[model samples]
Target: MKHRWLLWFCLLLPWTAMASTVQATLDRNDVHLGETVTLNLRISDAMTASTPDLSALDHDFEVLGTSTSSSLSVINGKQSAELIIGVALRPKHQGDLQIPSLTVGGSQTNPLTLHVEAPDTSASTHTGQDVFVEAQASADHVYLGQQILYTVRLFYAGDLDGGSLPNPDVNGAELKQLGNDINYEAVRDGHRYHVVERRYALTPHHAGSLVVPSIEFQGEMLDRGNPNDPGGFFNPGGLFGNTTPVTADSPEVKIDVQAPPASWGQTTWLPARSLTLSLQGLPGDNKLTAGQPLNLRLSVDAQGVSGDALPALSLPTIDGATVYPDQPKTSTHDDGEWLTGHSERGFAIIPQRAGTLTIPEITLTWFDVQSGQKKIASIPSHTLTVLAANGAPAPAATTSPSAVATSPAVASSAATPAIAQVAPAASSPTPWRWIALGSIALWLLSTAVFAWLYSKRKRAQASVTKPRIEPTDSTRTLRQAFLESARGDDRAIQGRRLLAWARAERPGLRNLGQVADALASDEQRAAIVTLQREQYAGVSAETRMDLAATFAKGFAWQQDNQAGTESPLPPLYPFKLD
Candidate 1:
């Protein structure tokens, strides 16, 4: 009887685990006054489960928005489904808050607690408090290379005519905007206000205190009457109402960035909330033939980090294989407060001979900001059985290996190496060689006599001329067009001329924005920004851009900086050179 009971229990273990489970979760248990909290009621194995009645939350929190998602997964021949109900909430007031237990599909979730504090309004010299800007960071402390979301929000109950908010500068860190500006409406302190938010992903390379400086906003604000606002109560928003140019600064944030973990001594440092590495290669069976090339696309995607932070992956040079990599493509997308980055590396995998080759596995270990522990994502190693091609010739040189069989255009782009000339093969000495030598000796003697007579007859030249420092044809043409556009009233024409000049110098530059970023001087970047704002801003003309000055600056920069003329990098396939 005991053995039978134990056997029955063992068989039922999988059934028990596969049973449905329901739980309540929150993005954060703590919040700031006026900040929003995201609550989720998640159910596992819940295909028939109905949405939970969140009406109980109305007692403590007001629902801002809600969304639901369902997912399905299969494990060990058992299928499991999940339903997630997301609810965004704003606290009715500040203090301790409780999210009551929710029941769905005969399962009950434990109640959760949230703490809220009031926003600090201090150390500000402003004309009105109704319109202000504040900076916020996800965390104040992080490990080196960890990504943090740093955002600046402009909250305005009044009218905003126009403004300019500069990008933030963080020393020892890289901060780039996640996406374009986000505009939304949120209710805070029982009042509805419009918010303009700009978010950035900050990744620190060095361990230390990364200080994010305050961001300044210069703009005109319309005075909308506020019952609680002492300054804007008397003034009103209208065409001739109080329109004052206000200068506001966001709060400064300091991040305590620590070095990577001890176990992670020295390797590719990738710190993010989530990361994945995937490779898709042709000939899915992992079989290769001599002189046959495989096309591979390797993608590295990470959340909470920018695409630039994810380095391109490559294999070192292999003995019997060759690799040709194209230019890497990178892009970053913003998913609300989170940022997703994707980088692709394309390569042509060509085998030189028939042999079993192993493409080593690649592993990327990253520190999960949420877990505060190291996590790993890897691509498994692949083995290829290469058979000799039908009738391909044997590779000529084993030392240098053979070139890839793909597009000759790629090979032609490679540098043209110098070739040494070979002398004629030696043969037995003959009378014909002697006869040819005698004829050459007579010809030289006649040429020397003619030269002596010509030198006496001609006086070489009347005078020696000085070499002038003349501009190249292209440079002269660019200057003439640039001057004409500078004197003209059309900025669009001038912009085109400037772009043409820049492209002439750096053919790879796609636009003025790229040229501006490549410039090493802040003044030049500012000049480019001003020109862009005017050309696109559609505002009244203000500052003057000196075309000659810009030309001189660009020319000097080109002569000194080689970054703009970077060449294609070689492949990275691992092998020993003996």
Candidate 2:
């Protein structure tokens, strides 16, 4: 009887857990005075399709919006479905507040608590402030038409989700969101912060104290103890998790702006604390021969600054050289109070002309956060020589061709290199036997030297140029690769690859909604969408053939565009190299 009872209890454990769980987690738990926050309710099992009761939250919170997303997944070979319901809330008042419990199916969640603080209105707030949205303008003052930076930050110490947040409205300034929202883990004020940070690159409109208006948001908090029911406390949800909803608000913030200095001409926008400039390849090393390609890399490192605010670095134009900007990446870190990170930019340069060409000084200028002034750092000019295609020098040499042919080995072994005769062959008349023999030897030596130089230049050029293609080109290439993978009947790999490609390609575009936005033409976009859904075996081979043709056409179009002088692609954004 005891053994049978234990078996039954074990069998019923899972059913008991399934019947009692209704989990809830907000996007942020802390908020400021007027910030809106999102509260998500996740139900473990299927429940009646009805909104959970949130009427108890009327005193401290107001609902702004609600959205729901449901997903079903098979984990460890067990099927499970999750229903995620979200609510946008705004705080009604400041100080501690409580959110009432919510019931889903037979399970209930406990109340949630949050703290809301007033915005700092004092002049003493300096560069740091509590519960404020502040913009780090790269320049306090700039000349008209000069570029200035405006980076907005929302800082606070309360539940973030469902907290009343105000929409950022910068009427006095020109603002542009750099890209999609950036979410990362940050450690601030000795506390580990999991923060959702966004970046934007803004150029002022008219220049002055451009005031970015306050943003308001709402969220939920839990009531600690009920004063009316001292003997019997009422928790709507239960003991396990908070079902209550409360609201919070973020403080209003302002920025002081000014005009650019008149002395600085129409220079690049430089909004940073400090910058480090570097030149990767030294051309003076005699590493290339005529008709051979050599690569040069330029990199910049900026710290105590905003990575997105980095300006483009202009390199000196070397004749017979081709240069292109490589796609850039930026890495940022925030230690609670201030954002401190490095932004790096790299360029690939190919030397086509063979001669001693001077690469002039490369300069990077930015606002010096430490000195509160403008500063510039530069890498001085350098010169390089490109030998003749035949592996011979332009200037005449006195040494015979025979001796010149043997010079390469001697230069490799000896401390000093021997100079050979460079006079015209017609001018120097010697015995035919010596001249013929020496000329043949010189010709053979030149072939071998040119071969080595070509190989070396090829390797160097590949290293530098490859980076320019991979980040942007890889995605388009994957579309074809994914089809190839599926052709081989590799559904799993194709599925994963398609998902990854979608993620990369989606955010890269200016807008989202349809796959056509990613492609240059409507026909190509339609083909890609059809191809994306072909994994279920319902798509015909004829359809697949059409997709393949469409991909080929699209690829050819991309290559044509890339080769043309018109740069349809977006301008180079700020990036960092790890």
TM-score winner among the candidates?
1
Backbone collision tally, model 2 = 87
On a 0 to 100 scale, what is the lDDT of residue 187 in model 1?
Answer: 51
Q: Which one is best on lDDT?
A: 1
Per-residue lDDT value at 6 in model 1: 100
How do the residues 1-578 of candidate 1 rate in per-residue lDDT, one tens digit apiece? 99999999999998688687888877656556666777878888765556678899898888988788999888999787998887888888788899888877678898899998775343234334667787888899998877788878887776887889899877788877876776555555565566787878778879988888998889898654444543433453333455778777887888899987788877677778888889887577767888888888988889887887787777655557888998999998866567788999899888877767677777777778888877887887888878779743334432221233233544543423311111121233355568878998999999999999887655543123223234568866876787677777687887788778767766778988987876777777776787787788865655766655765534433222344355477547556678
Which pairs of residues clash in candidate 1, taking residues 3 or more apart in a chain or in different chains?
Answer: 315-572, 315-573, 316-572, 316-573, 316-574, 317-573, 317-574
For candidate 2, write residues 1-578 as lDDT tens digits: 99999999999998776663677765545565556666778887653346777777778987876778877788899877777788777777888877767887667876677776663332244233224434455555543333344444545443443444343566754454544443323224333333345554444556566555545434444343355543444444332223245433334444455565666578775555557888776755645675665556666666544555455555777665676766666665543323444555455656654566567888777666456678888898876676777876655534664565566555533422333234444456566549878998999999999999999999987655533233467777677676676566554575565555555555443322233443456676665566556655467666653544554433222222333354578768747658
Q: List the global CA lDDT of all models.
A: 0.73, 0.57
Question: What's the lDDT for residue 408 in model 1?
Answer: 54
Relative to the unseen true structure, what is the C-alpha lDDT of residue 289 in candidate 1, on a scale of 0 to 100?
A: 87
